[model samples]
Target: MPADADIRERLEAKAFELGFDQFGITEAATSEQIVAGFRKFVELKRYASMEWMAERIHQREHPQNLWPEAKSVIMLAVNYGPKDDPRLLLDKKDRANISVYARGKDYHDLVKKRLKAFARWIVPEFNCDLKVFVDTAPVPEKPLAAAAGLGWQGKHTNMVSPEFGSWVFLGAIYTDMELPADNPHRDQCGSCSACIAACPTDAFPQPYELDAARCISYLTIEHKGPIPEEFRKPMGNRIYGCDDCLAACPWNKFAQASSEAAFHARVELNAPELGDLVGLDDKSFREVFSGSPIKRIGRDRFVRNVLYAIGNSANKAYLPQVRTLLADDAEEVVDAAQWALEELS
Candidate 1:
């Protein structure tokens, strides 16, 4: 085998042994087509309150601009699919639906730890400088993954692996090694608009573009203030992150349940009762979330999410539970609780 072919084979083997679901490598280069489109998207203010999207436009599009010496990027994805349909909880108005991703351990810590190990192995064998990044960095993981032949970027703006569907968590390792690049995947979305039509808030302004401010995922997890009234009712029982777009993809029928034990959903988080979640105080909340990603949102944001779920519940029995939180301190939490009480009452 040629040197490039040999390196690719070894890298694939190493990635599998390290617990990654899939791996691909690509040369560090920019696509002006993608950049131009991204620029137009930003100018339209589709990113809404996500100022960070506009702040790093240059670095996000051009990988070399992020780290000058980086010659190649190895993109890795870990699958986190669950056993049953995530949409089932939507029917139970009294139950809150947590996104499948946050139902398990935080992918940041898990993916980063594995990427660091992969980096240590790569540098010793290839003698290259490297940096690893999960979602926290400025690196454009979805675009890079598509460039590496992992999968096409679906209309929903997330990486869709042919093997793992849309349930993969992406991570990247930028290195000085000039490894052979894989062929980029072609756009496979074609005429399908399942995800586009399924969005409750119509967060997608156009195909492949998302307005995060209107997205339930951003509202419940990232936004700090009261959720706009327009989105609050549509948010339904989704307490953190929304999966309707991802779940609507027809390709998801090929998605397999994740093999990693740590990524499996904890029973407590699976269709949790709104009243039960609203009653959790800080200490109890910490204990419940413990090693899960939900803890990072902290107690206040979490209760705020639960309050939204309570309002959506339309269950008058939950009124007392929602009322109890109104006088409790955090402004965001108290505000949401008060709104929920009125809605329920």
Candidate 2:
């Protein structure tokens, strides 16, 4: 049997073998800083339409609250860096710019499977129980990740790794073993404000803060109604999630492009024509996005996003596509279609 220190070292080695780009360990404890920040975030309504965040505040405030027996947390990061600069697609006004992360297989499924495999190996070898989590859990992934020395949270409030930059997907494994914790990472974002300046919607009120209500990702993915007219033009051709902040990080200078085929962009998803996307009805939408993360928002919300993109497109070519949805049963879709037609006209 190996010593606890040896187990810690081997666990990290096994994590890299399992495809996680980075790994670190931290004791599972109540995080008052996380609680204070979350309270303020919810108090200010910064979570936008994500009422679930407010509902799960208690569980998020402390890791032990979620699982009492959890003695340590193993935070892992997987790089999903794009083969080409994701921002280059913005210049193609007639095409929709799906965020790089969403262009591949659903990360929740991929990361969770990898984590479960690691957890399965851990249980038998270490004789300890564990639980794995991706984004779906109420875990404070970023703070715990930073605490585990994976990376410091950047001005964009996303973890920025020295190796993977902002292109890393985070997951966690909580175990009963009291593993040695890695030294916490310190804030390395100094003087530079590229992420703040890159916001198309002025989503950042200040460095390290976000108003999700005005975030393009929130409007396109979470907000389930007619997009406020104010954001339509700034949204540009981005029909799914926005990547401006992530793409603007200077730390990406050290980032390596992801080699995972599972994270590579699907040809059909890369810069898809707005005309093609605007025509997707319910059946076709499901068919096209069958295994993609975009499917979760449903056809109505997706068409709504595309209509906003078409409105901002300044190309008359998509006017007919917008017109086709003028009588859509989803009131928000009809509203967006009308708005897009008026803008294009």
Candidate 3:
């Protein structure tokens, strides 16, 4: 077996070669701070309808609890920072605003493939068992990454890296081999409130805290049923996830666009016409968003989101699109259309 320092050095080199922008090592133990914060978020019902956070609290709070044999966690970051500002799309109300992360190939697939590649190379050399995770697993990714010194959890509650800003996708490899852990990062977001002020829905109830129930990302994506009337106007043209808080981060000045081709924005998804997207039936929806993460929500939820954007657009041209969905089989879609029609009227 290789020395811990030697393996750590080679692992980082391999990670970068595999297109990961940052790499760090941390012990597979959860911090009390992370557990406390998560419990508070859950206790407040801020996790919204995602009850799974509470369900898998133990696994999410403790990395060792997740995998007893795991001794080290290799935290990695892949920069998906947009070539141009994602916020620019917000002004074009006729055009739908897909978040920067979703405008390209799904990072879950892209990041996981690279993570497995790195794991394959390391496992044989170090003679250790390993497991990998992207976002789907109940992993304490941000807190673990911060503990690994890859970044610090910003006031926006997203991990903010000095080099990648908040636009990086995180993944982890849990290995039984012991690795030298990196020094934990200290908070770098001193006296800055830009991210807090950028929220259209006022999602931040306090600094460094978020009410996910009120988040545009949650409302348009994870949330089922019609969005509350109070949040619809603030949802604006963001038919998918919202990036205002991420874009508002001052650390982003150091962020360069991702070099990975797979992460680059797709032209069609960029500023897509609300009218065009709203017209997508189940078949066409699958065809258009075939490999994109947006496809997961299916046509019903997606069309519902587009209708809300149309209503907020104040552009009567999309009224016909809204009308066509008035009788959608999905109750949420019909409710969204009716609400949109009323808003537009």
Candidate 4:
């Protein structure tokens, strides 16, 4: 066998042994094809209040520009699928739904740790310097993963592994090691509009373009102020991230539940009672979600999300719970709570 072929095989085996669900390697090459579209998207101010996206527009669109020394990027995907569709709880009006991704340990920490280990192993073998990232850097992970033959970028602008759908969390190791690049995956979303249609806020302006401003995920996690009333009703029971678009993907039928114990859904997070969540004081909230991704949003934004869910509950039983938060110290939380209480009353 060729030396490079043997190295690639060894790398894949090592990745599997390290618990990464999928691995692919791609050369650090820039794609000018998508640059114009990405620029247009930014020019249209579709990034909403994410000023960082505007600031790093050029770097994000071109991977090599981020690190000129990087010769290859090893794209890794770790499955975080839940035993049940996260969207199933939407009909349970009194419950708050946390996105599958945030149900367990924070992925940023988990993925970065694993990537560091993988990099350490590779450095000795290839004598290369490695830098790792897990959504923390300007790395265009989804596009790079596609270029690496890991999967195609779905219309939702998330990587959709044919093996795991959109349930994979992406991580990358930028290395100076010269490795053979894998063939890119083809777009498998033929004649499918489920993701686009399922978005409550119509976040997708076109097949492959997403206006982050209208996305519920952005509103609940990234946007810090009051959520517009228009999108609240359609927000349904989602208290954190929205998974409707992801669940709607046809490829999900092929997805298996993730084997990583750290990615498993905590029973409490799966279908938390809106009343219970709203009743949590800052200390209790931190203690309950200590190691989970939800804690990063802090108590105020989390309570704001819970209030939106409470308003959409249509269950009068939660009115008292929503009412208690009406005088929350945080202005944003209090505003949302008052609006929810008024709507439910």
Among all windows of ten consecutive residues in candidate 2, which has the lowest summed lDDT? Answer: 29-38
Q: TM per model?
A: 0.97, 0.98, 0.98, 0.97
Across residues 280-305, which tens digit of lDDT does each residue of candidate 1 receive?
88999999999888888889998888
Error of 2 at 207 (Å): 1.5
Candidate 4: residue 225 lDDT (0-100): 81
Please write out the lDDT profile of model 4 over residues 1-345, one tens digit for every residue.
349999899989999888899999998875776677679889999988989888998788876778878888899999998788877888898888888899888999888888888988987877779789999777888888999998999988888889998899999988887889999999998989899999989999999899988999988999888888888888888889899999989899999999898888787887888888888889999999999989988898898888888887767887777777777789888888888877878
Per-residue lDDT tens digits of candidate 2, residues 1-345? 788789888999999998999999999974677789889898998999899999998889889989999999999999999877788989898889999999999999999999999988999998999999999989999999999999998999999998888999999999998899999898898999999999999999888889999999899999988989999999999999999999999999988889999888888899898888888889999999988999999999999998988888899988777877997889999999999999989
Q: All models: lDDT?
A: 0.88, 0.91, 0.91, 0.87
RMSD of each: 1.5, 1.0, 1.0, 1.5
Error of 4 at 249 (Å): 0.7
TM-score of model number 2: 0.98
Model 3: per-residue Cα lDDT over 94-153, one tens digit each = 999999999889889989999989888987877889999999888999999999999999
Look at candidate 4 and tell me the lDDT of residue 345.
82
Q: What residue runs in model 1 are displaced by over 4 Å at the alpha carbon?
A: none
Q: 2 or 4, which is superior by lDDT?
A: 2
Give lDDT for model 2.
Answer: 0.91
